[model samples]
Target: MPRQSAGILLYRKTNNELEVLLVHPGGPFFVKKDLGSWTIPKGEYDDSEEALAAAQREFEEEIGSPVTGTFLPLGTIRQKGGKVIQAWAVEGDLDADAIVSNTFELAWPPKSGKVETYPEVDKAVWFSVAEAKTRINEKQAELIDRLVALVV
Candidate 1:
């Protein structure tokens, strides 16, 4: 079976414009990449776990803060690689600069026999719906569109 993930889409309004939080993946492979590399803070989950609970857990794990609000289901989408992501939109605000992501170890430089630690998410930023469309992964852009229609 394909992998399944769950996540929360944090959204807030500023100056009458709707903005959503997007996170950049950490580590070397994503360092030089920008546009189309940002994504909602998410992580894989197994079938035994409740999707909403898993989404909240992943959000806190990836963003270093807890999220609590009425979640509007943004539904699910399958990425090009076939991983399915289920997401929810919540009206909330967080300081992007204050994010503290959890770390993961990876064998760096391919077979160098050394492990390096990197954050699951290096940074997060708030982007307008339009800007988010350009910054987020193509498959996940549907989440933004769903959010805009519901909130804007």
Candidate 2:
């Protein structure tokens, strides 16, 4: 079976428009990437773990902020390469400027024999659904479309 990840889609309505929260991957890999590189705050877990709880935990860990509001199930989606992602939508707003991210230890520079820590997510921003579609990976963008279709 493919790896599974659980995540939350933070959304809010402001000025008669809906905006969604998206995060940028940290470390050296994504430093220069732009559109289609952003993602929902998510993390992988084993079958024994619960999706909802994992989602909340990843949200807190990646954004370094507390989550609020009720989660509405948005169902699961499989990427073209076969990673299954489950997500829930919540109606809430948060600041993009004050983001803080948690770090993880990894062998930086690949096989350097030196371990280094990098932030799992460098930063987060709130974007309109229109802008999010362009920023998020094409496969993952489907989640935004589905969530919007179900809610709007």
Enumerate clash totals for all models, in the order shown.
Answer: 0, 0
TM per model?
0.98, 0.93
- Candidate with top TM-score is 1
Compared with the true structure, all predictions reach lDDT values of 0.96, 0.89
- Per-residue lDDT value at 145 in model 1: 95
Q: Which residue pairs in candidate 2 collide?
A: none
Tell how far residue 28 is off in model 2, in angstroms: 0.8
Q: lDDT score of model 2?
A: 0.89
Report the lDDT tens digits of candidate 2 across residue range 45-137: 887889998999899999988787888888998887799999999998788878888998888789898888899998898999999999997
Candidate 2 residue runs with Cα over 4 Å from true position: none
RMSD of each: 0.6, 1.3
